[model samples]
Target: MPDHAISGWAVVLGQLAYLLSGTFPDGPLAGAALTLWMAVLGCAGATVLGVGVAVLLDQAPAPLARAIRALLAGLRAIPVLMLIFWAYFLLPMLAGVHVGEVQTVVLALALIGAAYTAQVMEAGFAAIGQGQRNAALALGMTPLQALWLVVLPRTLRAMLPSLGNVWVSLAKDTSLAYIVGVVELSTVATQVNGRSVGYAAQVFAAVALLYFFICVWIESVAALLLAATRSRQRRPLWRYVTLTAFRLARTPARPPPTSASRGSSRSRPAPP
Candidate 1:
């Protein structure tokens, strides 16, 4: 390659490196580090809250279930940006506490993510069928035991792909944190673009590539986790019992033989 071409490529790489680092050692959190921090913590919070809410929604009384469903629906209806704004402006007043910009974004992301996660989990639970739990009950297991052993394992296994999608989406959505003045990756890229003349396309391309790679990494990890989950062949005692009972229930019953048919079989045997 020509020396000029090599120098141009080096300049592009240097710009990207500057954008990603963004005075990390000298200033407030910014760039790729901030983005990843928010995404990981936000998704973690979402998973825990979402899974818990799903279980509660499944087991709650009729009125409570309706209320929880309505709340989740409302959260889903709101945009992530709006949620961040609310968290940034309204939450402090409501709670009478000082919430940092970073914390606000993380909380907003978590709420929206949890709402989606709950819905996903609800679908997963529905796919599992009530029969699974009933089978556990019939085999002398308590409701909690049945849920923990028989129903949850199957539901999680079935929902693994969807949950992975949710994580990836949440990770991308962390960009919205810029609304709250959190200097994450996108913001740093924009700042770098403004300072560097005639390099907007390259700067933004770097940002896009960063996001692309992050999402790809998340998906790859999720796929590995899913494969591991599926490869697990060991079944707990409760699971084994419930599965056996379930299969037995689904098996078709044989009709009783008529007296004439029985007698015909006896005579036929003697003739043979």
Candidate 2:
């Protein structure tokens, strides 16, 4: 092995950086972009689908909810590799549609992530007390309103840590995108090794660090955003938008105008 491969760690780091520059001559995206892209898409779609499944499970009749739960459990039981194969090989046959390798990887991640996410979400929901819904009802809030304002917020609060964990897992799982020929981090690392024979350890070790730092970067950003929202309480971008939406849906109840009543009495009852 060359001394550059042994002692020149800086050279290795630089090569790693170049590999992850997220662009190459052939296309606009390479390893880093493609990896993070799949992670983002998978996490987003999973969150939405998981929440939807959770809601359905919560609202459906007993028999129906049990069926939904069974379905989710079945999904969770299936290996992610099988899910990927289904997306890549079986989905087109079933849906009569064609999606690229990128979409296939993302779809598999989302399908599996959603099942896991729903499991955590249901546990979060279970942690919540039913009395909260009653309290909202007592306060004249509709079921949907109570769900929107109270139940969901608390359930999400409980789910946040688990959701973060799931996100990290999905981010790392993007390495599996290589199986479908997606040019992600693992794929790039393999290519680099093919070129620099006998230094597979150095190339792959740097790639491993790259994955670690990418996940850490994502977690740092998420923590910062979470802190911002928590500190602001009602002033951050998401809060402002959610509050505005609720206000538009229905204004908070206000007492009748006491100033108007007082002014009308003074104008009409000068003799009294």
Off by over 4 Å in 2: 1-14, 21-25, 232-272
Question: Candidate 1 residues 1-272, lDDT tens each?
Answer: 47755554466688765567678677776888778788888888998999999999888999999999999999999999999998899877999887899999889888998999999999998899999999989977778768877787888889988988988999999888888788889888878767766666667777888888888878887898778668758655666886687678767899999999998888785544
CA-lDDT, candidates in order: 0.84, 0.79
Q: What are the models' TM-scores? A: 0.81, 0.83
Query: What tens digits encode model 2's per-residue C-alpha lDDT throughout 94-164?
Result: 99988899898899899888998888888988889899988977866777777777787778766777887
lDDT of 1 at 137: 91
Clashes of 2: 0
Question: Which regions of candidate 1 are displaced past 4 Å?
Answer: 1-9, 233-272
**Global local distance difference test of model 1:** 0.84
